[model samples]
Target: MKNRTIDYILRATWQAVSRMYNEEAIKYDASMAIAFALLSIDREGISSTLLGPNMGMEATSLTRTLKKMETKGLILKEKNPNDGRGVIIKLTPLGLEKRELSKAKVKRFNEMIRANVSDEKIRHFIEVTDVINELINNKTIFEK
Candidate 1:
């Protein structure tokens, strides 16, 4: 039987989700990237180096986002005591409030999906995703 490529399906699904988030974020005068960044940070702080990897973001893009967030008083950067060369991203009071709103939006989206999708299907989806990740990480994707 003919079928669509797995990569195409993945990309399409993600694009749809991103568009949906961007639309929702507009209502709060926020963007998906901003909400995602806020979600990635810890209450105390998160290391700049660690943040990029956690969010799968490029250094330049992340830097720009952080700068905007700081400008908006959503976050602050302080010297990391443990690493003088690095900084910690700390959410401000306003940042905390926004983060909570982001959290609720994320929960709402996930709950909507979970309510519609069966548990068994979700489990299979997770299993497939994990296997795909493992294959790529292990460089086994093209193995004969």
Candidate 2:
């Protein structure tokens, strides 16, 4: 247990995956986060407040990305009729196109992983990750 560190493994795996996505994103002049956000937004529309948490992004970062997407004409932010103070983000036709691209890239990545790894291993990995998240959420780590 001491020799095998979970955090180190998690970081290394995440970095490798990020690098792969970044390299692929370069062809589209986009970042993984932008692609992720594009896919995160719903077809109908999504609340501005929900976007950040859904993407695991901070408010400022989400705002900046949304602005950049808006500038690119990929998304349109309109008033949320139900929620006077909030905004709704919807994908433009261009955004929908880019979202499909992002989705394809993600699917390809996952397919490669599934081809290389066994389903049992993937299931176990997901279970481990869920348990880790649960532990973190409960603040159970390093507790007496």
Candidate 3:
């Protein structure tokens, strides 16, 4: 029963995230968009190889997404000065702007959800989410 409930919750969460992004703005591959959002917030540039594992993406998928982002002028890939073998990924100004817009939209969506949901339920949901995140992090359960 507990396992079933957890599985249902996980599926629901994924569906909600996918729907939220798909409905909001330009239609993009959700995973790639998520990667872009992470890069926008990452002060230090990230490596493509590191990103692929972190995002649970295959190397080829990451490469394709990076190429599209580069063509769109959303990101710049440069040789890492410290590690010549690595490529550093950084968001361009346009990418930063898009990220900001997406962040705002996400915030608004959250606000709407909060307004509709009871405070007690919202607090419980937050607590459950935090616990799940902690469990995944502590156990290193997520695919890399």
Q: All candidates' lDDT scores? A: 0.94, 0.92, 0.72
For model 2, how does the per-residue alpha-carbon lDDT over 80-125 read when each residue is reduced to its tens digit?
Answer: 9998999999999999999999999999999999999999999999
lDDT minimum window of 10 residues, candidate 2: 1-10
The TM-score obtained by model 2 is: 0.94
Of the pair 2 and 3, which is ahead by TM-score?
2
Judging by TM-score, tell me the better candidate of 1 and 3: 1
Task: Report the poorest 10 consecutive residues by lDDT, candidate 1.
Answer: 1-10
- Per-residue lDDT of candidate 1, residues 1-144 (tens digit): 123888888888999999999999889778899999999998988999999999999999999999889988999999999999999999999999999999999999999999999999999999999999999999998988
Clashing pairs in 1: none
lDDT tens digits by residue: candidate 3, 15-133: 87876666655554334355444444355668766787777777776778777777877788889888989989987887676667667777777899889999999899889889988
Better of 1 and 2 by lDDT: 1
Clashing pairs in 2: none
- Cα lDDT for residue 29, model 3? 33
Score candidate 1 by TM-score against the native.
0.94
Ranked candidates, highest TM-score first:
2, 1, 3
Better of 1 and 2 by TM-score: 2
